[model samples]
Target: MNARGFTEEQEEFAAAVRQFAAKECGTREQRAVLTDDNREQHHDSIYAKIAASGYLGVSIPEEYGGSGGGILEQVILFEELWRGMVPVHGAGTSHTVAGVYKRYASEQQKKDVLGAICAGEVMSISISEPGAGSDAAAISCKAVRDGDVYRINGQKTWCSDAQFASKILLVARTGRGHRPHDGLTMFEIPTSTPGLDIRPIRTMGGGAEVNDLFFTDVEVPVTAVVGEEGGAWRQVMAGLNGERIVCAAQGLGMAQRSFDDLLGYLREREQFGAPIGSFQAVRHRVADLAIEIEASRALTYDTARRVAANEGAPEELVRATSMAKVKVTETAKRVALEGVQLMGGYGYTLEFDMERHLRLAIPATIYAGTNEIQRDIISSTFGLRPGRS
Candidate 1:
């Protein structure tokens, strides 16, 4: 850990978050409900408690009714939140998007979204269009201005939590031609606006949490513009740095929890009168997992430092962030796989948490830019010669 990077105050914040996760987050049964399944039991009180605990808006500025904490505090909070498997504030997607708005949004825009975000009332971010998944610059959604309102027409898929989100942070084209990177813009459009429709897309793990949103002439006020009219590509690109960092943090937390579980299992399970931890392969696996996790943690925490310092996270850090996400997620997946393999039939059963971890880990490699995409990014950043070319 970077000792100088963490002050006494940050240490105390991390401790409190860990304690809260231990106490308030769901147990085995509750986790099954809060995580894998989509039960409509809106535990608003749980989020409220998180807010009252001064953690809901850890990274939002104090002027916006937050704790005025930095990215490190947020990393700590998320590490604790996901480590305990608690459903954190703003339904996942919104919290990440809100963090973007907090940093880049105009003063007024920040005030509009930050408070609702802290309260967990809104949840949305729609970068994935029907034809533009990894090719974010190829988005075809359009926002046409008329008087004081902009009429939106498009379809967004794989939008997490759009069904219940109060607002949708939409990106649409405001210009023309094949310059995929230019003339795009973003808007904070309320989900309840007329002509807006949301349908639940059943996912393997999260159940009603991800949705497909259809907009037909959805209207948003002029003030909804997040940045310059035709400057969304830059704005969206800037926000991705923070998004990758947060994703890395979440993956790290999951990896840590899986490692802890495996450690405990190895220490207790005996095979032929010797603990499993005594086996050479098991001992080596544990040691390797710990080392990989620590390396991922170092990269994630360093990215957070760059974000807080307002020093634009380097492309290398972006690559490192993706690398950490892929590495940590892969580590968790491997741990879960070996966990089941070692535990035999017990791993396949829902009575254990390893299966759920497996489900979650598979998606981490696919979302926030797939692991394949991350590899391409790293190669391009280093200007490595292409074999075919």
Candidate 2:
């Protein structure tokens, strides 16, 4: 009966998350303090609050220190958090790493890693390299097995939250297979390991959320491997479904925030003796944006439910998740831009947060695989293939 058809339990959980975000993370000033300097103290303080609320382990197994909920719970939680303007830096990456570990990590690894994640420790994944962004399998970082250990070397770009992460889930080239996607292996390595260096990447949106990582012969034990050696492609593909869904949720949350802010501004800011929202053209524009937002929410929620139910074959899940990702992100970008335009001069100022949302939305379409790549995946699902002219 909720707009998106949330169950009673889900609605109650969302209410709790909304309360938490309002009390603990509501203001831009509060978020600024929490994410400043990319320091561990701020990250820990905020995430500890979240973990205490039992959100950090949603969708993970109870035996592994999680709440044993389904993925839809996570989608709901993230949507609420972002809608409240909470910065989801560390928790987002941690949840992603938790998903990978849930399926592939050894029992002991789960006890250690998943437990730490639930306790609010940040974990990052390094996949994209300088030469490989969209082409993930084209990464050249090498992880050569030497006896019982693997020596890792090379660099990774856009590795978000590495500065605060306790460990990094690294993907590296182990050997060549018949296809480029083969021979990639995943390893969990301590961020403090010798020869591993992390440098922050500053952005216009204003946060130390991303980093460039350089590994100079860093070594990890064979036990560090998450799944079968040389089988990371399959593992990564499986994990991407979760990634896309989460990204879609993030976009939807941001879009909702943008729309809410614009509506508030329109209602109060009068022009020519009447509220600007009373204008016909403005009202029509708002109506169109509202329609798009609802459409995006429906698609995202439906896809999330399918993911939770394991309702389809892997390929079908890929298509559904990709569609969600593409639609929600594009909708977010449009909403954020329109929000800025609606707010006029105030929108362009740092005093208002709409500009920040715009900056964040711009990158959403690019990261988590560009919308162009997502379109290709959707086409392939319909038996269409790329071809030469």
Candidate 3:
């Protein structure tokens, strides 16, 4: 009955997730306590709870200790979690890492890494460096191969959950090639590896969820390379489509939460002896947001289905997923800001969760890829190049 046409099983799954969220981590006060002290321990405990419920592997394969589901299932899982005001930083990145492993990792690597991820062990990816954020191909992290091992030496920025991660999916330059992206390679390295330094980056939202990672002579076995040694460009690009879809799902969930909170406030807060929702201006704005949210949801679901149907078609998926990312994230940012505005001074304070929602939504537009990059991807799909157009 929902806009996305969820099947009976999907509906039941979503309901189960909602029930878990309500019973296990409900209320702003409860979640605040969980996030306030010993963040790494709290995050581990929360992830363990989620893993114990068998929800962590919704999109993973059964052979790898997953639930044998597809991308749409993952989108549903993330959307429901965000709607429940759950912090999805670990879960989202973990899923992306799992997806990459499933596709490009060696058989042994898949068995080890994917199973650990499904069991709630966090594994972060290091792609963005000081010199490269959106331009992943420009990564300067060097991994010099020496007989049976590779010595990694470089720095990575914006590596979320690096402090608590057991391993990191690292991208580095193995050798100089014909193109900027030609020399790249991927590896799975343990966080405890020697010469790997992790430093937390505090945000305005009062959380240190991201970090800067410095790798100096961090050695890994030759078998650690993912996919082809010099073919990481295709692997990275392929993974981005899935990442975008997940980001879109996060945006959709946050937007839905903001809309719900705004509507609740409008219905409860009275002005001139009537609910503020009775005001035509307020009603119209809510209506507009609702329309945009529905549109974003539709696009996101459609793109997920497309990705599921076309597994290896990276070029085709790029356009749809980029559009989904742009629409859903922009909608989330807009909805969160408006929710704060609608609630007046109460929304600005930490007492109300609206401000927190805004903090989370603003970053979605930047991470995964900026909205501007998404627009460019969409245009490129239509044969429009930067100079030619």
Candidate 4:
């Protein structure tokens, strides 16, 4: 079903994506893919095909070789893609990161990166250092300018999909002070650059999607700087705002999918000669899940509208994003957990997608800033300064 209030064009796009997912992509055995390079190769090849089909750059401007659609279209695409299990869901994170380059890159830089990204060349943002995490400004990765190049030295952890990324949107400190946010700069660092090392970090999810990125004397030309020197703090903030909204879209999609699965199980599974869905407890829980999903969708779409229209996001936008992420992702986790519970032994088995949805939801609270940090962002907005009156 189309999102409430979606335009006809958006509905048509959703239909198109659903049709593509079902007919072309087929069902995904994502667990098997995680263990084998061949599966990843096949996955990337599929992404390249999608990129060629012109849907990969859905909301990017036409000038940048994108469809120039708004974020509402993007939201619909995410929902449909997740519903379809089309295998390119995580790749959109790279495309979203490319927005920083599109907005802040010089014309030549934009031409170079945006073109490659539109063609499905993978790039990832490297902002989370071991010491940084949610307090991103506290990143200690240092970049020292030397003539035409900036030499970088430090380690970045939790670099998603680094094993496959072609380039990294690297954030480093160019100036020194105790102020964490000051004197930061962003550069497009090719992953193959000398002195850059990437090693996969194993996790419960089994995807090896996160990595440790080490840079020692890695150098990028001055031309690689995305925006003005030392202006990266604000630039990254803007990109992050957009990132949170995009993440909320993903979270909403996963939640919806899990809820749908749960509903199906409840309708079909028999308990005491009656469908589980006939139970008051099960029905009430399902209704609550539906309500929460709809609420999350509304907030996410509203935030997308503000971003796409170039309007200043309300101060609450951050908290709103945080709320959406926290609620929707946690909701996804709940739905997945209870889905597994309600489905009995089958839910815990590898044969089901509910477990994978649970794995995916676990990381959502950690990425794009953790839920605890999100609460801080929300609390900081209330102006709790003492004696201000």
Q: How would you encode candidate 2's per-residue C-alpha lDDT over 79-164 as one tens digit per residue?
A: 88878876667878888898899888889999999999887889999899999998987999999999999999999999988998
The local distance difference test score of model 2 is 0.88
| Candidate 1 TM-score versus the reference | 0.91
Q: What are the runs in model 4 whose C-alpha is more than 4 Å off? A: 1-3, 24-42, 310-314, 385-389
**What TM-score would every model get versus the actual structure?**
0.91, 0.96, 0.96, 0.91
lDDT of 4 by residue, 230-254 (tens): 8888888776666777677778878
- Kindly state the number of residue pairs that clash in model 1: 0
Candidate 1 residue lDDT tens string, 1-389: 34736788888888888888777764676655554453331356667788777677788788887878876787777777767767653445766777668656789888878877776576688889879999987788889999999988988888877777788888888787467688788888888789988998766554556778888998888889987888777777776666766677778788887777767777888888999889998788778778887877787787678776766547776666666667766766776677777666766777777666666667777877888887887777787746893
For each candidate, the alpha-carbon lDDT, in order, equals: 0.75, 0.88, 0.87, 0.76
For candidate 4, the per-residue lDDT at 25 reads 48
Q: Between 2 and 4, whose lDDT is larger? A: 2
Instruction: Count the clashes in each prediction.
Output: 0, 0, 0, 0
Candidate 3 clashing pairs?
A: none
Model 2 regions lying over 4 Å from their true place: 1-3, 35-42
Off by over 4 Å in 1: 1-5, 33-43, 89-91, 310-313, 385-389
